[model samples]
Target: MAHGEGSHNRNSVEAGLEARGAELTGRLIKVVLDGEALHRLSALQEADRTQAVADLEAENEFSPLSHPELESVLHLSIQEGRMVFDIRDSHETPLMAIVLAMGPFKMLIKDYQMLLDSYAGAIAEGREAKIQAIDMGRRGLHNEGAELMQARLEGKVMIDFPTARRLFTLVCALHQKL
Candidate 1:
């Protein structure tokens, strides 16, 4: 199997992950359909890393797996800050729009609300549950913050002098819900 650049090479990718305190492993696979090339490389968990590989045909096109498959793909393991998939793909290039066209944008917004709901549930549980509950509440706020960040990342929204006020109001509303 051949390896690509940008955090995919076995040694470099693992080294990068180690620097960040996450341990990961690499797998390089070259798929051939009747001897024709269909390249696939996977960096999986050292133990049963095979679990990390998903069949391209089995997942929804809008799901992260297929989303990357259509163009070149990349998967980022958030916990590690290391890309599990290719990092080179991008807009105006071989970049596959995250097949979430149904809309991935809306789904991201919905995810933010889901996180808020999770926090609300925790808050209602009681002060005896304070430690864990507070943690959940913090995560809820984080989710909303992440949503705003993702919106800007996807170019679905942007910030300037005027938008900050609206953003502030949005945060207040979400906090009230929590």
Candidate 2:
């Protein structure tokens, strides 16, 4: 988990979220994920505070999680060694649970952790140059993950790239916890 220096990094990550959350935007009103599944995946869960901020950012999509009486929730979980996306509507109706094999993202998850570690180290050592480089890698990896997620959810859930990116970030958060 990120401590002192890491705190700054974490806040910057969600800084844009608070700024954007003031408005009623985006499709989902909330996203839910439990710790049981996360614990089952790994004993390396990040601090709850960091996890909450990540979840909040992902759910809010940097914008407020407000919309019409349309679909508004996605329940993320893991079952039978696979990832489950249990999406629900405003009335809490079952939309779809896009189940995906965890294998495909295995490498990405590993890379994500590496980047997080590298970022933390860079921050700790005050290596601004390294941090910038790591940030670029983070963005590229995020885009790649988003594209993969979109392809996997094809014909199932129709969401924009940014939404998919947020969802993928959510997935990364889950990976940290996932």
Candidate 3:
């Protein structure tokens, strides 16, 4: 059955192409915040702020499956009181750009700053119980922020909880710059 054999071969080729396409579109290879945004992050106190930025840079990854057309590299910035996401392909081609309002994130960022200050004070004074309590509150706020981000990006992009959290931190850092 030569015709049957040819059909099977075509099907296999199409499947292979689909798989490759999926692999390419599934994940972000890297993410970078704009320089001015990073300068804002630098304004944060020396130790913990630096560590948080490092953690975000090293560990954060995004899966933009909701918008399969998005590229592998992403550039983030804050402009005119809005968060800007520039999605780029592997060859540095611009794909999609999204801007989200910053109003919803304001209170969360303020709470995060307060928690950071309290945590630092507790650490300085060697208050273990207070440190744990403050840390719990900090995490709660962080989680809430992440959830809000996910909700905001609901139809625009697909990101996991951890990615949302790291992005939230970056957004807060950008707010300080503004």
Candidate 4:
């Protein structure tokens, strides 16, 4: 094959891959933690609460692997000792509700809560040095939690690493800090 032809073929392949990726980018329009979950997440300071939600929604990837075309709003709730992912379409039509036992995530959630409290305290006190270190720990925990989530949802839902991290953060927030 001519060198020019080979280059053109590669470009075509790249374009096709990009198109396919777009198809799989199932967006999460909103994520709501049901009221029964928690009254307040004291680990996060009052001021940063709103921003945290914004951060999660800013750039998240969530699509039911089984239904990539179904963009959704998710309602998370704890029911009967399990976490429920109540997914709905744009029109508020139900898509699927996945219930997962929280046992697998118990310890991870506790660790995340501790990190959040430490991180929030560091920020509030203007302890710049501590802030970076705490954030590093937070990231590590988030990565671990995300990996666990991927394994747990392997065939049911498709959430990229970042999305899983954000969702896990929210779950930690749902825990009533003691």
Q: Looking at model 4, which ten-residue stretch has the lowest summed lDDT?
A: 1-10
lDDT of 2 by residue, 96-135 (tens): 5668998877787679768877888888899999999998
lDDT (tens digit, per residue) of candidate 3 on 1-178: 1112333433454465467674313456666667464553433333444555566556654545444544477788888888898888777788778899988888898888777778878888999999999989977887888888877775566565676777787777667632
The lDDT of each candidate is: 0.30, 0.60, 0.68, 0.70
Shift in Å, residue 91, candidate 4: 1.1
Question: Candidate 4 lDDT, tens digit per residue, 1-178?
Answer: 2113233433454465467773456778877777544566463633333554676567776768556766788887777768788898888788899989889988888887777778878988999999999989978887887777766765567666667777776766665432
- How well does candidate 2 match the true structure in TM-score terms? 0.66
Candidate 1 lDDT for residue 106: 42
Question: Which 10 residues in a row give candidate 1 its minimum summed lDDT?
Answer: 30-39
Best candidate, TM-score-wise? Answer: 4
The TM-score of candidate 3 is 0.73
Q: In angstroms, how far off is 97's CA in candidate 3? A: 0.7
Using lDDT as the measure, the top candidate is: 4
| Model 1 regions more than 4 Å off | 1-104, 127-178
- Poorly placed runs, candidate 3 (over 4 Å): 1-25, 35-37, 40-61, 65-71
